[model samples]
Each structure stands twice: as structure tokens, then as C-alpha cells.
Target chain A: MREAIILPTLSDTMETGRLVQWLKQVGDSVKKGDVLAEVETDKAVMDVEAFHDGYLAGPLSQADSDIPVGTVIGYISDSPEQAHEDQGSIPEKTTVAKGMPVGKTTTKELNQRDTSPVATAKQAVPDTDTSVPVSSQQSGIKASPYARGLARELGIELHQVSTASDGIIHAPQVLSAALAGPVPNLDAGPAYRYKLFTTMHKAVANNMIATLSTPTFRVSARLSFTPLKDLAHEQQQSVTLLLARACALCVQKHPHFNAVYTPRAMAMREQVDVGIAVDIPGGLVTPVLRDAARRPLDELNDDWRILRDKVKRNRLGPDDYQGATFYLSNLGVFEQVTHFDAIVPPGAAAILSLGAEQDGKVEFTLSCDHRVVFGADAARFLATLSQLLDNPKDSLCDAAKDQ
Target chain B: MVEQVYYWQALNRALDIELAADESVIVLGEDVGLFGGSYRVTDGLYAKYGEWRLRDTPISEGSFTGLAVGAAMVGLRPVVELMTINFALLALDPIINMAAKVPFMSGGQFPMPLVVRMPGGVAKQLAAQHSQRLEQTLMNVPGLRIAVPATPQDAYWQLRQAIRSDEPIIILEHELLYFSKGPLEVGLEAPPMHRAQVRREGTDLSIVTYSGMLDVSLRAAEQLTEKGIEAEVIDLRSLRPIDWDTCSASLEKTHRLLVVEEDSRFAGAGAEIAAGLTERCFFNLDAAPQRVAALELPIPFNASLEAASIPRIADIIAAAEKLCSP
Candidate 1:
């Protein structure tokens, strides 16, 4: 017995998932609850786990390509021999059984039925038998006039164009099929291959474009970071964690800084949740610390430790990284970054960027959505933050608690 | 410059304007001079223009319509009124043989400045006899022209345009649209009477309809917007000389076509639209052209069945959604 493995929907708005890599090879033994591969969604990389205990089968969908949701990525078979079937059939052929479901027509019979795509399409007409299935979901494929023309021009076969559109192929499906263009007849130019963009890269680009409508202004100042650095070293705590905790405290003191501007009214947030940016393999993510201002220092450190571990393994989910009242991005490790400005993400009033320490001072640039907070409010917020950073013994008490 | 008026009032205003302007223009039909026409389209013209210009005759469609055909053959421009299109069936002989072919058979010697006005489509419980839409019969004739105006503004513009033109024109008005009100700017410039108008612009599909089906198609297009299907509504104001250019241009962008009609499905107006567009826009289409028309059976006398027999707003929406579902 064999069960098909389909791509699962990871988010509310997700339409497709990119397969990053497969953890198990064909013919390899696999058990239930085992992660068979890693698939990347718009937000993060997620695990595609096996629900059935069997050997991973062949004809697995390739990696580094986006597959629509509910697509058959691979199969799990009960025997190794079944799992080792050659990868000759494309994904579309597997969707249709090639011939009419009449006493199991063989590949040789299907081959003899047609020498051209037009001929094969005509062969879908039922024979003189009375037992043909009533409305076999895919007994026939009907391509629109425009789609057929597109396929002909692009040198793609109609059967190879797969769509979720009942039994018809429209122009959109044909255009997507043409996405993998044939080798360019660049008869005079050098050979080059096109690589599609990953979901994470596209998500980041779209997120940046969304913030372009917000009116923003940046305020910069050199803050004393040596005291916080010494406090972190002496107490054995992460600098980024302490930074996130300090930003959360500052946000709590300046409630106006936590408000996001909306058309109806300015929304003042209740709890202080700080999102700290972390670099991942292909892109970056901002894992959030929920209730950072109200939670105890030891709990905050433990949450930060878990978030750091997830970032290391690239397994951040939406709950772990979304809807923060304030944001902290620390580039102090990249000593070359100094006095850089960041855009204020939607749903947040401001983002604070920290640069590497030079002459015992660190550059802190606060980028704010001007609709929520003014220049004076930003200046006051910065003054409060600098005062806390200068006197770390009084401010770093809970953040320095044992993790 | 724009005033809201009922469809019947728009027709009355057009007739009043033309009668006061031209002495050669005369009206002859039953009850038009004394009773002011069935749907009140010729209201008050009896008192203003008197019986000579707005003359009412007995209930003899064949003889009266043939009399207008002869009057148009000479110098006078005749505009004949049949209370409903069902009665026009008795006058098809003079309409098909005389009014449509005289100018051509005479080598352009006699200009057929004739306009025949009638109300059509199912209305209330008019039953099957009175509620007939035999446009396919009139449209099959070559020299004849059909103008199906949906709104009061178009009703005003097209009736005047049909009266001034030399060709034989049939102004087929819907029985239900007589009281339907729309803005009428009598002074505003009008497009060529036969040019199809795009009521709404969309990219998903094109809905080609005329007369009674125009308003229904527009409402269906509005509802389809909420379902994520943007449908373009094209009012084929003139059916015989269908403006294929406008429909073909829409198909160039949308790639899908849906024809809506109040007539039957077999060889009706929608059939010609789908077949004609298929021939011209075969490569541009993204799906087979579809139609939303009345059932092939005779329209039932029951009210609910009568309503169900023809294409409603919901029917057009469902057909459009299916075409663009891909």
C-alpha cells in the first residue's frame, strides 16, 4: 500500500511552498512523525513530516521549486521495491492515468493511440463500451483557444499544463507552464540559466513595499553601550537579549511610542512585545518576545534563549515572530555597520537599530512612523533609553537573571 | 443638461420633437391618435400634433403597415406603431417584402424612410401568445435594421436617430422598460445608433446582450465583482448590424465571451453572437463562448414559471463565473 504525500498549508494566505531539501532519499526507511523534507513558506522554513510508516518512494517533486498547496510532493510505499520505481513519469501524467479507465490500458496501448498532441486529445472520446466512468474528474482536458495558441507558440504540450481548474486549461496555467522556458537560442551570447526567486526573498520585498506609504523620520544619537557590554559580560548574558529587554522597558515608559497609526484612529497597544531581528540561512527574521515589559527577567532570558535556538535552526513560526509593539535590530556583530537607519514596519511605531561600539559608545538610530510619534517624543524616548543604558546596574537587573 | 425620465416619456419626447420639426413625418397606428398608444409612448401627441400628424387607424396590422410602406415609397416619412411585437407577426409580409426590400429592388430610387416601433419580451402574465420575442425572424432579413434600446437615454437617442435615417428600422422596446427611468440629455452628442456600448469595463470576461437583458446583465456583473470575477457588459443596442468590432476588441483583452438574451436558446440572438465572435476571435478566446438564454420551450403562462423560463440576473452571473472560473 502507498499513500501520497501532499504539501500542507502553513499560513492563512499561503498559496505555495518551496521545497528546500529532502531529508530522506528514495528507498530509505521512514517512520511516522519523521520529517521527510524542509519546505519554505512566505514567513519561515517548516518541516514536512510523514504521517504513514513506510519507505520513501521515487518520483519525488524536485527541490528549489515552488509547489502549489495540496500538490503530491512524493509517496510512501509499504515495500522497498515499490519505492524504487524509476522516475520516468512527470507530475502531470501521474495526475491522469494516460488512458481511459477501461480494463487497465497499458502504456504501449496509449503510445499506439497517438503520434501528436492533437491526436492524443481526440482519443479522449469514449469507445463503444458502456462502462466508462460517469464524469471521471479528468477523463478529458479542454484547453481554451488562447491557451492552445500559447502552448503551441511556447512549444509545450497541452497535457503537460496542469491546473486546478476543474477540467479546463486557461491562459494563466499556460503562462505558468512556460515559466520554465526552453534553452535560449542565444546563438551568439554566452549560456546562462534563470533561477526563480525564493518565497522568503519575495516576502521580504513585498513587506518593504508595504511600508513605503508610511511617513517616516529617523533620529540618531551615540549612546553609552560599554556599561551594558560590561554588565552583559560580567553577568554572562546575551547582548541582543539585554537590548530587547531594554527596548521593551523604554516602550513601556513611553506609551505613545507603542501606538500604531490607523485611518480610523491611533491604536495604543496594551502590552509591550519586542521583536529582535535575527539573521537566518537565506534571509532574516524578527523573533518576538511576548510581554517583555511585564515578564520577569529570568523568564525573558529563557524566552530569548529558546528564540535564539529556533533562529539557529531556522524554525520560526508566525506566533514566534509577528505583531510586536516595538522592534530591535542589532548589527553590532557586523562591525562595519554603524549609524544605519531602518524602516518602521507596519503595526509598529518605531524600530531601534544599534551599531557596533566605537570608543565605548554605540550609534543608536530610531526610525519612527511620524504619524504616531513626533520628533520631541522620539527625543524623549531616546533620552530615557540612554539614561537606562548608562546606568546598567539599576536597569539590567532582571535581564541579567540566570537563563 | 441631464433630466431623469421614463423610457416611454423619452420616446414621446422624441416623437414630439420630430413631429413639430418636420411636416412630412406622420404616425399611423391603432389608438395612437386618440388613446395615446398602448404603453403611453405617444401620450399627449394627439392634442399637440392633432389627428392628421398622429393619425389612429383601425386594428388591421396588415393593411395599416402596408399603407405606411406605400407612404414611405413616395415622399412622406412614416413611423408606424404596433401596440406589441406579437401583432407585428401579422404585418411581417409588408415588413419583410416591402419596407426592407423596396429601396434595394428599385436600385436606390425609393428611400425607405420607415420606422416600426413595438414592445416585446415577457411581461407579467401576458401568456405565451402576447409575450413573443421573434427577433430572429426580423434579424434574418438583410436590408432591415433592429434597434433594441435598454435605457431611457438610449431610447430617446435611438428613436430620433431611427426616424431621421433612410433605411428601414425596427425599434424593439421591452414591455417592462416602459416605466424604467434613466437620465436623458437630449442635447448630448450620440454615438452611431448601431454601435455597441460597453456598459462596464472588465478583464475576466465579456457579456454581450441587448434590450431587456442589458439591465439584467449589468446587475449580474455587479454581483460577480464580489465573487472576484470582473465581467464586462456590452449592450449590443443594435442586433442585426452587430458591432462586432467592439465585441472583438473586448475579447482581445478578456479572452472569454458570454452572451445573454431573453429569447430562446436555439438560433436566438445569443447563438449568432457566440458563433460570430467564435469565428472572429477564435485565437483570442480562453474558453468556449457561452450563452444564458430562455429555455427552448414556449414561455409558460404561470408567473413563477414564466420568470424561470427566461434568463434572470442570477443565471447570467452563474454562467459568467463558470466561464472565468479557470
Candidate 2:
């Protein structure tokens, strides 16, 4: 028996994985669970284990190429002699092409049959006329009689119906077309190849797109940043951490801001784990600070330092970055970003966007999910935040001392 | 009013009632008098109606079934009990040539009222010869009608209806269904013996089956319902001159059709159904009509192989799924 080793998906965002190297040479006898090769996925390098005990064979894909997720990488044959006989000649995954008759008239068996009309009819027909006239009509669409009548009743042309995965148009395919309103043909405009995206890039894209279904309204106020900035400079702390801490405290005052909108009911979280957006090369990440509302300042500083180092090295696992009840995005470092607003992800009630300090004030924009918090609640949240920023010295020092 | 009864007991009760009501009603077959019939369908009838009305004949099927036909020619309603349809092959000459053609040849002078009741289809380990279904053969005879009842209620209703009709009819029973139980309302009005019955109503696809396959198709319909495919189960109670109006009406509602039969697929009863319906309801079908029938081989003697050789519940479900799938 021979088994094909196909590339497997190693990460949620991995459309393609780059082959690192193969540990086994051609014709090497291997056992099940042996590491055959290493695959580089969207986030990390993972081992591909042998699923069956066999001799490794090639006509294999060369290492360092990004192959599609389900493409065949190599093969394992039953015997060593069979493995090395036809090197570099055997093909990859085989498929019955669409629209081909699935059972291509078993002529060899039909000829061996004692009686066959097909065998008898073969002697009477001429050989030159080869095209099957049945499939040639209606632009070569293969459909059933009832599906044709349904398309006529629905006022849809036969050629316009989308063929199902089996390459035949049926009632279900026609019904789905009736429900699909005005589909666009974007492939006619663009020429492109599938790209292997990093996990961080996928995270940002999906989270942003997911917020489109949420109804959001932004509230902006000019809050003084000098109080928080001076505290950061004097205590050797990060301004973003101090800002997240102050936002967590304000969330503690107004519990509605700590809630997320769910289909069943509002999920009011008990503790606020604030997420601070950080920029890295080629992508972005948000490493959460757990219990930011109750933790001490020095401990928060140490956790933030480690998270920053992990982000720089691209080592943030899902546990370190997921489940943040509130978010803070700072474009203050750019110093030229006049104003901006960040989208509130599904799990968070709101995200606060901060711009560069102009004079002594910073424009803070709060984007809230209206389903969880209304306009008046957001106004009160901003009022409390402005008060905390106006008195950051007492708020941060007294809160840290109490903890 | 209504009571639960086994399929064979219902046929026995119908026979007893018919014999008591008509002075011309007489029954004769091998073991039907002293042995109380092979499947107990004639149990206690010989003692109740006496030896004159119920006569046990010799083992020669062709001669005895011929004797019943000759008796019917003299204005008697003869219900001939053949042990099984496998043996009915020996009597086809008398059944097809005389019983079917005599009334037609006489042209309003003679009316033939004959009922041939026998159990057919794959029973546990009956093997090849004993388990053959020959409804298609009898259906081909021009002046004949065939009723295949699948339940006790239907067996009771259709057997009584078949005895009362003036035409020659064949009651094709399944060997496996003799002991199966259902409610029999004896006084319930009967539909025409040739009419089809919808055992279960659905909208996804129409399953036309008869005899032993009706229960199989109904079980398959239950499984298909859990898979979100609502299958309509139509029991084709009669085979000859099939109730095309009922089946076509079901096809108009559910444009997909699946025909299940215990006979072999090639040129079997299902072949006639799929072709005849495709011709009549061609514009109404959304998919090519499909069939679930016995494999084109002799019924196997081994237990599992015997079960696998004919249309099982799973086979019917899979065929219905494919017909309903895109």
C-alpha cells in the first residue's frame, strides 16, 4: 500500500505553509510518529509526523517552497524497492476533472461481457464523429429536467446557474442563485496569486471587518495629557500603560463599559484586562494586561516589558493576546497624527483612540458599541476619563499605594 | 371497532367472512384444508366452511390451480391458495392463458372472479428459488390485476376488495410480513383495490414502493427526516394498471421520485414505474428517477448476504438521499 503525504493546515490563518527541510532521505524506512519534515506556518515552525510506517519516497516537492495547504508533499511506499524505482516521475494528487463522465464506460469489462449492446453497436458506428451531442447543447450545461423547468420559472438562464461542486446544475444550485442577489465578478478586474499572511495581519483584518456589523458612534473630547505624561516621565513608566491603567479604573466606575454585546444578554465582565496596541515589523498586535484595574504599577510595568519583548520577537501566543474587555490605541508617538478613531472589536464594548498632543491637550476619541452602551453612558465615561487625566498624579499614586 | 392483528390473521379473517357471505365462494390448494395453509392464512377455515367449500388438493400446482379456474368458469368465486409465488410459475399457463383470457374471449357472456393469494419475496434463508417475486410477470398479463398489501389493515381491506371484484386478481404477499402486526378496522370503507396509498406525507421527494419494501421505505423516510430531507412514502398497493394519477400528483408536489422494489432492478417492477412515470410526469421531475431494488443475482442463502441482496432500509435511505441531494 502507498500513502501520499499531503500538507496540513498548522494555523487558523495558514493558507499556505513553507517547507523547511526533510529529515529523511529517499528510501529511508520510517515508523509512524517519526518527524519527516518541518513546516513553517503563519506563526511558528511545526513538525510533520509520519502517519503510517513505510519507506520514504520522492518526486517530492523541494524544500523552502510555499505550497498550498492540501497539495501533496511526498509519498511513502510499502517496500524500499518500490520507493526508489520511479524517482522524480510519479505525480501528485489526482482528481477526476469536472464534467467528465464519472464512470468512463468500462469498455474493457464491457468487451469481456458475454452480451453487450455497447459492444455490438460499436461495430456499426463510424469512428470520425466523436463529440457527444447531448452535453454540447445549452452551452454544455449538465442539468436535470426539473432544474431546467425551475430555472425557467425563476426567470434565470441555464448558463447563469452556478454548477455545484459535482459539476452539475440542480434545483439547489438554482435556488441558491435566486437567493444570491447581484453577485460581483471581481476576478475579471484583478490578476493575483494567493498570499501567505502572517497571523498578526490576519488578526487585524478579521477583527476590523467583524466590526462592520456593529453600530458605532464616536465621542471626542480634548483631555489634558500633560498630567499623565509628567507622571510617566517621573516614574520611568510607559505612557500607554498609564493610559490603559486610567481607562481600567474608569471602567471600574462605570460597569456598562466593561460589558460586551451578546445575542442572549450583555456579558458584564468582572475585571478589566486592558489591551494596548503595539506596532511591530510587518504587522500589529495587542498584548493584554490582566487585572489592570486591580494590579500595582510596578507589576504592570514588568508585565508590559515582557509583552513588548515577546511582540518584538514574534512570540505572542493566543493566551497572551486574546480576551481584552477594553482597548487603547495610541498614535501619539507619530507626533503628526492629528486625530484618529479605532474600531471596537466584538469582545470589547469600546476602543479609545488617542492622537498627538497639541499644546497641553490630547484628543481622545471613544468608539462604543451602541448595543451595550448608549450616548449618555459614553459621555459619562469620557467625563470620568477626563477627570482622571486632569488629576493623574493623585489617581495613579493613590491607586498604586492602595494595591 | 378497530383491533391489532397479524397480517396473516387479517387475510384469514377476510377469507372466513367471504366464505360465509357467498354460497359460490370456494377455496382449494395444497395443505390449505388439513394443514391450515402454509403461512396460516387459511387456518381454521376448512373446519368452519366444511370440506365441500375448502378442498386440499394434491401437490401438482398447474393441475389444481387449473381446477380452480374451471370451477370459476361455472359461476363460482374461487380463491386459489398457491403456497408461494415460486410455485406459481408452474401454473402460469392456466393463469395467463385461461383465467386472464377466458372472460375477454367470451365477451360479456362469462365473468371471471378469481383470487390467487401467495407469499413471495426474500424470507430469512429461503434462498434463490423460494424467494422470487413474480408480480411483474402477472402484471404483464392483459386482463389481470395485482394487489401488493404491506400492512395488516391493507391486507384485510385489499383481500376483501379483491374477492368481491369480478376480475381475476393476484394478491402478492411478502413471506417476511406474515407475522407483522398492525391495526385492522374490519368495517372501514375500502378504496379501489387498484388505488395507491400515501403511507407518509412529505415534500422533499416521493418514494413509490409496495409489498415488503413499503415498510423499508417508511423507515428510510424517518431517517431522511433527521437529515433534513422530508421524504414522501407512497405504497403502490396495486401493480397492474398502476394508480398513475396518485403517483403523478406526488411527483408534482415533490419533483424527485425514488422507486423501491424487492424484485431485481433490471426490467423489474421499478423499471416499469420509473419509465412510466418519467413519460407521464416528465416535465414535473427535477432529477432522473432512481430505483432501489434487489441486486441482479439469485437471493443468497447465507443470513447476512440474504439481507444484503435485497433492498434494505439503509439502501433505500441512501438512494433517497442522492435523489434529494444536488
* Model 1 lDDT, residue B300, Cα: 92
Provide the lDDT at B143 for model 2.
95
The worst-scoring run of ten residues by lDDT in candidate 2 chain B lies at B317-326
| Deviation of model 2 at A132, angstroms | 17
- Full-model lDDT for every candidate: 0.84, 0.84
Q: What lDDT tens digits, residue by residue, belong to model 2 across residues A1-403?
A: 6799988887554566656567787799999988797766544556677999999887677665566677778889999998887577233223212332323226573464323111222221221245655234454577777777788788766655666545577787788777654444332443222244666688687777678889999999899999999989998998988999999998999999999999999999999999988888886788999989888988999999999989988898898899999999999888998779988977999999999999989999999999999989988999999999999988876797886
Worst 10 residues of 2 chain A by lDDT: A116-125
Instruction: State the DockQ of every prediction.
Output: 0.54, 0.49
Q: In model 2, which runs have C-alpha deviations exceeding 4 angstroms? A: A1-183, A186-222, A246-344, A347-372, A393-403, B18-28, B51-78, B93-114, B139-145, B164-168, B185-210, B214-260, B272-292, B302-305, B311-326
Candidate 2: fnat, from 0 to 1? 0.81
Write one digit per residue (lDDT tens) for candidate 2, span B1-326: 88999999999999999999998998889989978998999999888998888989999999988988888888999999999999999999889999999999999577889899888999989889998997888888999999999999889988888888888989999988999999998988988888998999999999999989888889889989899999999999999979999999999999999999999998899999999999999878878899999999999999999999998889988888887766
Taking all chains together, each candidate's TM-score versus the true structure is 0.65, 0.68
On TM-score, the candidate that comes out on top is: 2
Ten-residue segment with the worst summed lDDT in candidate 1 chain B?
Answer: B317-326
Per-residue error for B171 in candidate 1, Å, reads 1.0
